[model samples]
Target: MSRTPNPTRTLASQTLFRGLDVVDAVADGCQSVQEIADRTGVAFSTTHRLASALVQARYLQFEPRRGYRLGTRLLELGFAAYRDSDIARSARQNIEQLAGETRDTVHLAMLDGDEIIYLDKIDAQRPIGVNSRIGGRKPVCCTGVGKALILDEGEASWRTRYQYDAERGNIHLPLETWLAGMHAYAQGGYAFDLEENAPGIRCVAVPIRDASGKTVAAVSVTGTTDSTDEARLRSLIPTVRGAAQAISAKLGGTLG
Candidate 1:
């Protein structure tokens, strides 16, 4: 059993928050202990100690000259959580059909903070397919799957998410431009990524809303620009949207 915290122990609990701060710093791209300390506003020695402890605990890993990165424990936990997600499980067959029909990679994704995580990916049998994985993350503001997942959010809230990302130092995407694109996508009931997330890939996506009418996830079909130009992507929108609806229904999600 965990012991009750005395005053000294209660004060010491700040270390737990500090350690988490360091972890967040690393997630935000701070690699070295000095960088983590600088970002977290903690002393260098304290940051190093906490980072060292995290490394020992397998929450972080060190490479001889490469500094620190997220460890295997995170991958284990992430996959465990993803594998247990009902949406991911329910959407697999629908995603497979989308891929098979389009002869392009299809994805099931869920919003994670200011990002979208690929919960499942069905690769096309053809030689050309997207280079994404089941557990990879991408910026939500620029990806079709991400925009579709957040389509219901108000413009202000959308900008707020961009702000959250900016605070974390991810400012590559411009807010005003993205908001304009998001507005069009939301109105259209489907989103498109035209070389936004990747230079040569195009995608069409629609939201997966639960029975309560809450957007719970998103589904997208991805293809190469060579094979899927704007005209092709526009044509495939209905197919992708239909696939999303099928998965939503399977998940007890709303069709409307």
Candidate 2:
């Protein structure tokens, strides 16, 4: 009987595997091309070519004396991966807990450029829930979690975003009024929707930070105006904030 070719090995790209080996060698402290070649068992010329390509693409950095080291591009990609993985892993329990406690919809989201992307969403047990999913995207100008994600930004940025949204008809609130609300939200360390994003939906949200004290994500409890009035939404601040802080703490962050 003939042996079936293993697809994993047969379909693998040798060059790609060699490049990864080069990266792994450098990660394991092999600085020189000769050292990397020895560590990866690849030919010296191939290793040198791979290293040069890596340096040009910023996967590795070269120094005259220090040799090669991991580059800023790797750091950026690593942090983004870490942020996403850590937030999802650390926020799952807290998100579930928040949903259970409030009996309302819960959302965990992160800012992506000028938009907010939902990383996770736990729908309420009730018949009506917030119209959001794990990967839904929303404008950063009009949602509670969106505002919470930008709590650290300056007034000028706030005005620019608000004006841009207003011009596009995504928002109708005057710039000054939105700015005033944002100021209060920043001071209080939380934000509210007040039906800004949708007709009757209200939400209370708080920022989740990382060890560097930067807001990497946000958490929110959402409900309809019938179930969550302004007073009730305000009341959920502490509950929502507690969940955000719990996730932040797991991420080595502090929240006040």
Candidate 3:
């Protein structure tokens, strides 16, 4: 026997979907009830009711001047989700895949007091791979992963790190040139090491962000100059960035 659909259940499901649409519209910057209704194609009265319910549930907030905005409840949920995330474990599979694809060294690193510490490293099977290991620390001014870690920082911070590296004789480029390069890299959302970290070694790197869109770590792929020429290094940028983005997505983030 064919069964007819229940009217109450159908209405409830439609209401749930409409409520979610309202939330999406608000999140996308539809502040006023009429704006949300226009965006969601819901009637004005229904949109007002939905927004009021959402405000009562703490998913949205209303102010005198500002119509609607995301409430603190979403922030609390984001924090809780990030607190339970393990970045190293989350990044392992992606980095491993990157190494396997490129047949080169892969590194996952985080900034630590003006330096970057390697949280994970996948060494290439080749004999002449980079000599970095897990827990190794490197200067933050001359390495690809190091630059990626600071992409969101201001020029003042960049100068501070550059000066620190220069005092230690770790910097080879002039401050002006390095700063210019950093500006370009920051704008491009990636960085490169043109034999700056070690002679004959080159790398491409991208930042790994957290749920709140903070650059919490970095990922890089490195190879010798002979193996990774200019064209080859440029070709590896997308692959390295893909690995970093995968890690960021696992951490409840999205890459820009």
What TM-score against the true fold does each predicted structure earn? 0.80, 0.67, 0.66
* TM-score of model number 1: 0.80
Overall lDDT per candidate, in order of appearance: 0.85, 0.89, 0.90
Model 2: ten consecutive residues of lowest lDDT: 77-86
Model 1: per-residue Cα lDDT over 113-229, one tens digit each: 878888998887777747688877888876888889888998988888878766776446677887888889989989998887777988999999888888999988888878889
Cα lDDT, model 1, residue 238: 86
Candidate 2 lands at a TM-score of 0.67
lDDT of 1 at 241: 82
lDDT of 3 by residue, 1-256 (tens): 9999999999999999998898778878899999999999999999999889989988889997999988877668755754554988899899999999998899999999978988888888675658687766899999999999998997999999999999999889999999999999998899999999999999999999999999999999999988889799888888888998899999999778
Note the residue pairs that clash in candidate 2: none
What C-alpha lDDT, on a 0 to 100 scale, does residue 6 get in candidate 1?
98
